[model samples]
Target: MTTVVHEFDWPDRVVIGTVGRPGERTFYLQARAGKRTASIAMEKEQSAVLAEMIDRMLDELVTADDKLSIPAEAPAELLDDAPLDQPVEEEFRTGSMRLGWDPRTAQMVIEAFPVEEEIPGSDDEALDVAAETESEPSEMLVVRIPVGTARAFAERARRVVASGRPTCSDCGMPMDEGHECAPEADA
Candidate 1:
């Protein structure tokens, strides 16, 4: 029973949640409610309980980079009001869902739960979407950094992201990287 409760957008004062497995389908979050950057979605057991609540909320609230300021009173589940690129009608969707992403790891399915409501050719006219809401628990933005300067800047960004080096792979291009706006690749 993987825990799931995502949805971020308004935070400031230092929010830096983490968890970007980038596989299977969705589970991406490089949160920074304070600095404004955001992304959220989960399923793999709610992305392992939001990666242990973003390592205990960045080990007691961020402080290293001092740039997690994403607050403007917009946190109720802002993902543009969710519906994640819309178009999904697989009979509304039930459980045991499967369909991941790989934009370097994953973070695709922005909204999907016990949702249901398919209206295709008719197969009992599926209908379940009573109310699942990303599962629940999304109120991010808790920066308090200083854990050794955010672990020395996350060990120098995990050694420059493990140094595999292979340029040009912005699978979904969430902007901020050369300003090409990846809008989930036009969703």
Candidate 2:
């Protein structure tokens, strides 16, 4: 199997932003390294999960070493509604994501796996496809951002997620414009 890796070492900017209104928002992660830039599409859930993971990691790092200046929240002045760069075609739709600390490079590595769409029907056919595809390596997007920027990105992402439509108190699901929840459904 061939492995294709796209790496951005010490990106100048890495941020998560949305393209539409609360309920219909499309989250994207854009990283700029040197002259090349990469923008990837991810679900809102993925963004929230990534932000939560980053936040937890930053907290752990700060706790482990009191010297790290990772703040709980980014400075308000630093947060802005920056638009995604031109040619915003998604490099890939994120299927899975991971975060790691590289001691050798002293940088945090964020890797995102491309979404794999499976054709559903017969189990045998699915296994055959999976086996066939197993020989082909999937593309992964990797970015290394500064700790401060990572923290800021997490904070901004948290805000963006919270800014979504209000949730139904009973079912704990997002409420649409005319969302109706039945007492039985709540249970």
Candidate 3:
């Protein structure tokens, strides 16, 4: 099967959002360019990591290109609070995600590859590198978000992650409704 990469360059909006309540929420990364929009379901960890990498990449881009118009400060809160668009069909459940900055195009590329399952009894030694490179990914979702949009995404994603269950101040473990850390034994 040929690998089809969905690219969204110069999107009108790129945002991270969730569905359901705090504890039982499902995270989604959505991008809108013209009339087409792509939404992909992802783990909270993926969202956090993507946000972090984007922030780092944007920093590098700013240093490389002095004329870039991206602002240094991210919004204190999400600029858009709208939920995932209706008929939210997930493109794919992301397994490995990557971010790259294209100097020629001056666009940040975010790519999501489908999770590949290992067949039982498959020998790793028998798999050749060329075969691997030639094989097409079942699906890939690529979105080129601008630096400014990326910053907003990073900030909002951090907020969403921090808004999860409270953590214990001392042990840093997640605290439930009635969580009571065992008292320290006489040391």
Candidate 4:
């Protein structure tokens, strides 16, 4: 099958957002440029990790010899707190992602691939069947943003990930309305 790439370069907006309540939220990575938009469903962990990795990448760029104008923090003007665009249609569920830096353009590139559809069969049969088929994604989302926008995107992604269910102070696990913490262990 031919892969459809939703490419966005120097996008007008890109962010990680959620739908539903705190404990039952579904995370999505959305990118928009002009009238074109692409949204992909992802796990909360993925969103958090993406933000962290972006931050780490930017931090490393700050110390590089290239002396590119990397920002120490997201510029106030670029901080985007707006909710995701209307009609947030998910193109696919993300299975894997790749991140890279383009030195020539001073841009961060993000590519997300869809999860492979599972074949109906036993484990061994599934593996055999999968091997017969082409091992490539049918669709992908490619987004490129400048350094400052990348910083802002990372910051907002982190906030969205953290906005989920509050954690138990004692157990360090997510807590619902009636969640109870385990007692402290004796030294």
Candidate 5:
């Protein structure tokens, strides 16, 4: 799995030591000659077998010990995209504040987060007693929003509520009538 190579040069010869594999086989190679030595993994066997093969190969070849250096000419990367060009305005969530995109003007509209409260008394059973009905606040909110993208979000909410039951603006969770979508009764 792991291969190690060692190269040493003497005044007269060089000695190299290495161990690892030869493709599908395992072996270590050691080469020693006049003034040069290099070691590397070359086969599937003991270093002795590798040395015999390496000795035969190195004995006939021209040996050089100098290492040449090459440099890359490509320019370094620069952060050319980012610039002081825009301000931070768009946001995902803002507590009770809400906004939606308007296709007409490509802007945002402020929205009213509808809030509903239940009757405290167990007066639900008194539905038959029409006169006993309690008065409730108007669920519709008509807050004036500045002209721009922010105002568009609210206009969309108003349209959606006027259309029918309201749904979650973020995830499209349906709020059916008499439940999540219901407005406060003005009874």
Candidate 6:
């Protein structure tokens, strides 16, 4: 089967956004350039981790090379606070993701693969399936953005992840309208 690669090089916009209420929201990683768009569903934890990882990577790059033009924070001009584009259609559910830096272009590359369905069989059969699918993924999203835009993207992602349902101070669990905090037992 032919793999579909939704690639966006220097895209006009890319972001993590959600729909529905805080506690019942559905996270999506959307990328767009001109009239083309690709939206992929992702878990809330995935979005948070992706943002954190990007920030950490950028920080390390700054420390490693003082001469590099990496910024300490997202530039004001690059800040994106707008809601996601209309007609948010989910193309796929994200499974594994890869993030990397392209020194040649000074861009951060993000690749997201579709969730692989488990084949019910023995361990050996699973290994065989893995080997067969290793070379080709059914579909993937590949986005490449500059450092400044990457910073902006990361910042927006962090905000979106944090905009979820408030957490209970007692149990550190998400609190809804009818949530009850569980008491902790003394050690």
Candidate ranking (lDDT, best to worst): 6, 4, 2, 3, 1, 5
Candidate 6 residues 1-187, lDDT tens each?
Answer: 7999999999999999998888889999999999999999999999999998888999998998787898889999998888888888999999999999998898899999999876676799777977686668889999999989889999999999999888888888998888987688878
Residue 99 lDDT (model 5): 32
Q: Better model by lDDT, 4 or 5?
A: 4
CA RMSD of each candidate after superposition: 17.0, 3.3, 3.1, 1.7, 37.8, 2.1
Writing each residue's lDDT as its tens digit, candidate 1 over 19-40 gives 3333324433233443344343
Instruction: Give one digit per residue, the lDDT tens place, for model 5 in 17-96.
Output: 22222222222122234434332332222323322333332222213212311111111231111211123221111113
Report every candidate's CA lDDT.
0.32, 0.80, 0.78, 0.90, 0.28, 0.91
Residue 88, model 4: Cα distance from true site in angstroms: 1.1
In model 6, the runs with Cα more than 4 Å from the true position are 120-134, 185-187
What range of 10 consecutive residues in model 2 has the weakest lDDT sum? 178-187
Candidate 3 residue lDDT tens string, 39-130: 88889889999988888888877888798866686755536656667767788777898899876667789988877755445567555654
Question: Which pairs of residues collide in candidate 6?
Answer: none
Q: TM-scores of all models? A: 0.20, 0.81, 0.82, 0.93, 0.19, 0.91
**Residue 6 accuracy (lDDT) in model 5:** 29
lDDT of 2 by residue, 1-187 (tens): 6667777888777788777888898888888877788888999989999999998898888889786666677766666567777767777888888899875655678999888766567799787977787864467789987676777788888877788899998888899988877757434
lDDT of 4 by residue, 60-144 (tens): 9888746788988999899989888888899999999999999899999999999888777779976887867756678999999
Worst 10 residues of 1 by lDDT: 85-94
TM-score for candidate 5: 0.19
- Among the numbered candidates, top TM-score falls to 4
Question: Which scores better on TM-score, 2 or 6?
Answer: 6
TM-score for candidate 1:
0.20
